[model samples]
Target: MIWQPLLLSLKLGVIVTAVMLVITLPLAALFTRVRRRWLALVESFATLPMVLPPTVVGFYLLIAFAPTSPWGAWLERTIGLRLAFSFPGIVLASCIASLPFMLQSLKSGMQGLDSRLWEASYSLGKGRVETLLRVILPNMRPALFSGMILTFAHTLGEFGVVLMVGGSIPGQTKTISVALFERVEALDFAVAHRYALVMVVISYTAVLALNLLQRVQLERRS
Candidate 1:
């Protein structure tokens, strides 16, 4: 029983972390390429979901996903997908909640890059997109890997947003954190203990493994 939400959380975490990496890479690329003046605004927007209370983002997303709005209506009409109280909805929530981890990691990595490297790439006839994929991402691998682990762990603990939008739909959106909360509220410490311990071990081991990998990468590069 406890394993159900635990596994679901893992699945959601993997999906969200993967999507966040894909989305943040080019979005971070835009920040590096575009006007410096717009960087702060872009970053603020990207990280907004991090600072805002989860319920606020959830509330707004809820509104946006409602039947009336064009964006929500189009999503439903075009894809036959509904964003409320679904696994997909939880994934989107995880994406939003974890956005800052991805952006910040990518941004910090970008800042460390030598300007001359990009110039050299252009001089060597590499295009922008090609350079990004081949050169930039290679350099950013360590940061990107670390960011993904952080985002996955953070998404596992997500509650308020999941609560507001996902509504504890078992086998669909009831993540381990939500399940833990349910057990705790019901004074079922025995069950909650099992869930919490699993999460603790998973989070600790996953992060430890990533950090070790990062250290190894840095050592090899050095």
Candidate 2:
């Protein structure tokens, strides 16, 4: 059906965004607090995915997830989960590809916080966890929103990495971008136009909302 790939893309985006949020939030918080040289290296590594070619990341991931590799072998033998060309596999790939978008946005947000807020919370006998939940996170709403939107948008448009890792398994790994590519190759211009138009609208709306959010945050700060 025409809606299958679009729906699958939405599903992939949501899952990838949720996973990145869980994985990147703590990392971003920690990065904002740390200043060691080694931490800089770690941060650089975390952002490398954004700079690397998608196919390069996909190639390495493909090898790592191959059944002959130790990690893949152990995963299969222990839990009977095979990642290569599978839904979970593409999920992991999308997570990696989208990590920097979420991480950088959140880290910037965390860094933009005034030091006095958390210090004030500490002086008031609030613990780190309490301050993070009540004070820190509440202040970073713009960053959170921006990160989620960016991650979801990026995942929806993922093609090279998704194709290299998951291939074109319909109803499983065939996302909107992948489906669009297939349509074009098959010369199905009408269907391809539909997919392209949807992506454009979604991407523009997300960016516009992010811009408005930033403007509002700036206005409130001033």
Computed on alpha carbons, the lDDT of every model, listed in order, comes to 0.86, 0.92
Count of steric clashes across candidates, in order: 0, 0
For each candidate, give its TM-score against the true structure.
0.91, 0.96
Among residues 3 or more apart in sequence or in different chains, the pairs in candidate 2 whose N, CA or C atoms overlap within 3 Å are: none
How do the residues 1-222 of candidate 2 rate in per-residue lDDT, one tens digit apiece? Answer: 778988988999999999999899889978888677789898999999999999999999999988899999999999999889999999999999999999999999989989899789999999987888799988899999999999999999999889998999999999899999999999999999999999999999999999999899889979
Q: Which ten residues in a row have the lowest lDDT in candidate 1?
A: 60-69
TM-score of 2: 0.96
lDDT of 1 at 26: 88
Instruction: Give the per-residue lDDT digits (tens) of candidate 1, residues 1-222.
Output: 768898899899999999998899988888877778867886888889878998898888877776677887899899998888889888997798889988888877887788777888999999998998998889877777878878888888888888777879889999999999999999999999999998889889878978797789779879
CA RMSD per model (angstroms): 1.9, 1.2
Deviation from native of the Cα of residue 210 in model 1, angstroms: 4.8
The model with the greatest lDDT is: 2
Clashing residue pairs, candidate 1? none
Lowest lDDT sum, 10 consecutive residues, model 2, at 29-38
